[model samples]
Target: MTAPRTGDQRLAGRTALVTGGGSGLGAVLTHALADTGARVVAVGRDEAALERTAAARPGAVLARQCDVSDPDSVAQLAGSLADEHIDILVNNAGVPGPVAPLTEVEPQDWDDVFAVNVRGVYLMCRTFAPGMTARSDGDILNIASVSGKRPLAGRTPYCASKAAVLGLTTTLAAELGPQGVRVNSLSPGPVDSARMRRNFTMEAERTGVTYEEAERRFVSRALLERMVTEEEVAEAAVAMIGLTGLCAADLDLSAGMVAR
Candidate 1:
């Protein structure tokens, strides 16, 4: 979905908790929700980054740092927010696991990736879903990736963790839908950002091509012929949050990367 050029108060009076809300797509998403009139809680482990996110709209965004993968940390966060009602949960925090063949993958790396991408979601759901059900109203948006729909060579751990996310998303939707809570996933392609710029640079060096040439080849696989924009992804996320009956559905913000 395209972002509205003008802001509106569609989500007024609602409170949204966005994990990893300090940088990259998370920062964009924080602004998107806040612009829509939702009080946004920007959650991340980086205190400074969270501070940066909250600085944009000091009144609308509240920065809170916690390790999503740790159950104890999430518990503390939940306890702190017990008096507040969270209308939406955007599980956006993630880590790009080491790129290597499955056989060469390290055990610690595998566990770490899974801990953040999979276990983190589980902990958040466990801590928050009950409260949502009790209120009989809430929505969950899992920031998955198109890579989850297919195998990603040299990124097996990342792929596997995301695939687990898809599995968890559907199952949780089934369990929570009966109680009037909705859960869904959003899958976006490679985003244009500083992190991806580094990836593109590495690709240029690896393939003996110019950075622009490597980036061109990278987007050629996508039907849209370009990587996704941050605003586009954030718009899709805001749209997902507004959905009422859509549970277990995945919103593809991949610019047709998977379709190709």
Candidate 2:
């Protein structure tokens, strides 16, 4: 999935850090951000994957391995990058929790999801917001999901965690707006990626439906009747970062999912 080129260096000279930047949509975002002439730090738990992502953009994108769910790891990451002021932070690290009913979900599984999806964002913001506040400039984009606004049966943990992210983004925007730091979130619908494929496969098995049928049912809710592409989400992230006045906004790149 190739992101459309803008031929514009809007974010030139900016330093951006993207969590979960090793693979999937995160990798796409890292590339997109680098294309805008921003030096990007791609952080994730997988060293090999992060290396591959950084290899694509060479010097423009640096790969770092850090588990966002760990406080010490996040602190260490912040310490390592202390010399460079991060102008943009994309909290894209998240996990799709168990695809089962609430009763079938284990407490630990729920905690694990929150650890990455919710706590991870909190930790990143807590660590980095102060620098932005002191400088009086920065952009924080939290990748959320449409499942938070609508219903995704049997995905309580994932849904709840994303909903929390929306709340966090808005409140933080208010808290930090006066200080000149912009906080916002991008909520994309079921993106066409390996993650969603796994989700559809699980849903099919759980509901006794064919994989195609399960996927169809999920996309049917969107007015576009299709899953959003990774490129679309990445493009939206770049656009949000460039939009200076856009703060406390939950940009729904969900193919009209919320409308439906």
Candidate 3:
């Protein structure tokens, strides 16, 4: 298999399973993997969006609607994909939790955030790790956030869940590395995505600022003075999976954020 332009393209001829592939960074990662000749299985709760992602490369993609929080649905999806052994698993499915302080946040919101961010990653890893271990050559990339490392005032549950994911990635890397299966977590800053926009809107309302002003302030928080693009995160994902000798246990893809 010939590698593509980016070193991440070393994934050529492999099979990839990307959760949340219907949109945001997940969609970009799916596109990048397909570009490098990997057959991709795109999973999400939105069937139509998944179909669109599949349509981009009809022969190279299988779009499946999956609610990662629901074990039964995940089991069914796993059964359906039994014929396709995955070589790269990207646990990108996530939910933006309520932008409320810990005291104001509802219990249900916290539960839902952990269910998707932490439990979803655990479920995907459990479902796929055996196959990767048996093959003795595969990569697992979990999409975490910088907020996981550095707490955000109003995102208590999100911060907790992402921190758990970072810890999980490190533990899995240690457990799976000996089997030639690499597990890593990529922590991105505020990415320019639909979710990011929605988050900015929420911030604006909560802080009594204009959306544009909130976005500006948010962007200024990063060293680059802008939100990182989804493509950049995808690029990092590909690089983490592609380069042969580099098995980073935890990769921080933040565009120059203060490390916590």
> Which candidate ranks first by lDDT, i.e. highest?
2
* Per-residue lDDT of model 3, residues 110-171, tens digit only: 99999999999999999999999998998899999898988578889999999999999988
Model 1 residue 125 lDDT?
89
Tens digits of lDDT, candidate 1, 92-195: 99998776678978999999999999999999989888988999989999999988987666678988999999999999999999999999999988888776
The global Cα lDDT (0 to 1) of model 1 is: 0.88
What is the Cα-based lDDT of residue 73 in candidate 2?
99
How well does candidate 1 match the true structure, expressed as C-alpha RMSD? 3.6
The lDDT, on a scale of 0 to 1, for candidate 2 is: 0.94
Off by over 4 Å in 1: 1-10, 202-210
Candidate 2 Cα errors over 4 Å, as ranges: 1-8
Lowest summed lDDT window (length 10), candidate 3: 2-11
Weakest 10 consecutive residues of candidate 2 by summed lDDT: 2-11
Higher-TM-score candidate among 2 and 3? Answer: 2
